[model samples]
Target: MKKNKTLSEMTEEELVGEFTNASIAQKEASEKDKFSKYNKLFDRIVEIRNERKIRPGDRRRDLLPLLTHDNIQVRLMAAIETLAVAPDAACRTLKEIKDSNWFPFAMDASSTLSWFESGRFRPE
Candidate 1:
């Protein structure tokens, strides 16, 4: 991986790779958060959030259409990651590309929507 390059300096392909890494980290079953890979991805995701905070860039929103990326992993990652920065827009997009109910990643995206809709913690 290239070092010292800010997230803003990354190309679209590089951003996709970073998001893919994040998706992997999020989906991993191991109850570990100290791992370098996961931490690195977490930082990148935060960087994106902060970037959007300062200036709402069209480049960032460009990722919206990637929800239907030919690669399912990319499509899956795009939704959950985008949810952090663009919840309303991400939810709208997720509704269109969420694949069938049987798609595991679709379920992941659905769960993210549920997480947002139900609030952080809801007790029965």
Candidate 2:
């Protein structure tokens, strides 16, 4: 029997690769199963919330806490992904962060949320 690699043992690239592969595989398997798979992956993200090493967009809800991550890249990506999924909910959070020191990221989130709310980006 082969031992599975723990997420902690994987490099950032490896973790992203695994997530991408899982996403693709789940998408191809069955439309009805997609949500379950996505939820499972999301659960995995929740399990590692404190690990401080998750890939961007791993968990939609993770964006809330990441709005204040020390790394701008992480914060920006989280804001973008959160807006993409829930523009309305992101609006308030974005507003709260807009005047903070991380103005650039807050602006990105606010703009994206506005665009979505404006019907410029319709769901497919």
Candidate 3:
């Protein structure tokens, strides 16, 4: 039989330490599972995308393609994530889509970009 551990039984540092020796692939798979499991718990993907530990250049490249994802929420998250790293690089793409006929979806992206530029919302 497996012994269950309470959340309080493990400190954050202890939890991190347990995974410290994991291979990169193992760590990524775990993170993906966690992200999918808690996707609705706020913008977790965006948070991951903004993590300093992620290679900024690689993230920037990945985010560009996500901007065109079929899911509007994914696209919005990509826009936010891209802006967090390279606001100027994302500005042109965002401006092109801001006036799209997608109603509130496009509007929301535009609003988020505006807020980011005005410093109303700081990423990380």
Candidate 4:
């Protein structure tokens, strides 16, 4: 089953699909199991994003569009994924989310902004 694939085994499209579904699930339901799945998938996606950052090419372009997706979680995760390699654009995305005033997302964006200020979001 597709769900059996390890994080390293997932293609970029597959990763995006899981992230999008997780975002949808988080939005449509408040169940603990549902949110737990989203949280796990989000952590996996972030891990892969960070790993890819250490590679030699520009990959942030692929995630940039997701920053503006209709799903709040998708947008938030995309902002986190892009923060290191595309600081200016990611910061702008975070600002937009923060200004949108959706409390949860704004709070996440605000914390991410603090990471930016502290240089914790990017590798030295």
Candidate 5:
């Protein structure tokens, strides 16, 4: 009979959990070419980011540990999101992913790095 907490009321750990789940769902949706679902999940992840960013200490760096997650997509998303907080670690992870020759994700990592380098994508 416990009431469910809204995302805004969740703790930092809860927000990270939500971000992880949303990232996984987004990856699955993308694989199925479900653009609508994927986009929704993407927005949710961004909302989580915004929520964390405005917190007293800016806990977005809490995602840094996920940079080594078993799921490549999760790791990729974490690296991309944490770029502004930990640029060196994030770039190293992206390079590792790209160099691993893992299709789709490797390509994504490479493209993300290129975008960062060219100032087309700025991690907030």
Candidate 6:
């Protein structure tokens, strides 16, 4: 039997890799309307959130560079996740995505920004 390393047991690089993979998976799951799978992926992200919290540094900032990633889903999730540590860059990335007019992702970005602006959304 193989043992799975918990998020806390993973290094920063590994954590980032997990975050990227999960973000992509969640995006695809949502696109296919696989709500259960999407929710599970989101749960993984929530685990990553705890990983970030338990670490000493501002680990969430590690995702800042991903704001410019080629994949829109990666960029979108990175922006939303890092909003607390990098508001300017995150908001800029979200705005760019929203203005790109790329259908559902653009809609997602717009809605996220709306919540952010209206004080309805707060990244932990």
Expressed as tens digits, the lDDT of each residue in 25-65 for candidate 3 is 33344346765443333433333433423442343444566
Task: Give the runs in model 3 whose Cα sits over 4 Å from its true position.
Answer: 1-47, 50-61
What is the TM-score of each predicted model, taking all chains together? 0.50, 0.38, 0.49, 0.71, 0.90, 0.90
TM-score of candidate 4 against the unseen true structure: 0.71
Alpha carbon deviation, residue 25, candidate 3 (Å): 25
Stretches of candidate 1 off by over 4 Å are 1-4, 8-36, 56-59, 81-89, 92-107, 119-124
Model 1 has an lDDT value of 0.61
Full-model lDDT, candidate 4: 0.72
Model 1 TM-score, 2 decimals? 0.50
Q: For model 5, state the Cα shift of residue 90 in Å.
A: 0.4
Instruction: Find the 10 residues in a row with the least total lDDT in model 6.
Output: 1-10
What are the Cα lDDT values of the candidates? 0.61, 0.53, 0.52, 0.72, 0.90, 0.91
Name the lDDT value of residue 13 in candidate 3: 42
**lDDT per residue as tens, model 6, 17-104:** 9999998998889889999999999899989978888899889999998999888989998999999999999999999999999978
Q: Number of clashes in every candidate structure?
A: 0, 0, 0, 0, 0, 0
Q: How close is each model in CA RMSD to the real structure?
A: 6.2, 12.2, 10.7, 3.4, 1.6, 1.8
Off by over 4 Å in 2: 1-59, 62-64, 84-89, 101-103, 122-124
Model 5 stretches astray by more than 4 angstroms: none
Q: How many angstroms is residue 94 displaced in model 4 relative to the true structure, after the best TM-score fit?
A: 0.4
**Highest lDDT against the true fold, candidate:** 6
Q: How far is 89's C-alpha from truth in model 3 (Å)? A: 3.0
Q: In candidate 5, where is summed lDDT lowest over 10 consecutive residues?
A: 1-10
Instruction: Report lDDT (Cα) of residue 15, candidate 6.
Output: 91
Give a tens-digit lDDT track for model 1, residues 1-124. Answer: 7676777787666765666666556545223544676556667676765554455454455567667666554565566556665677777656655555636556766776777678862311
Ranked candidates (lDDT, high to low): 6, 5, 4, 1, 2, 3
Which has the higher lDDT value, candidate number 1 or candidate number 4? Answer: 4
Best of the candidates, TM-score: 6
Better of 2 and 5 by TM-score: 5
Count clashing residue pairs in model 4.
0
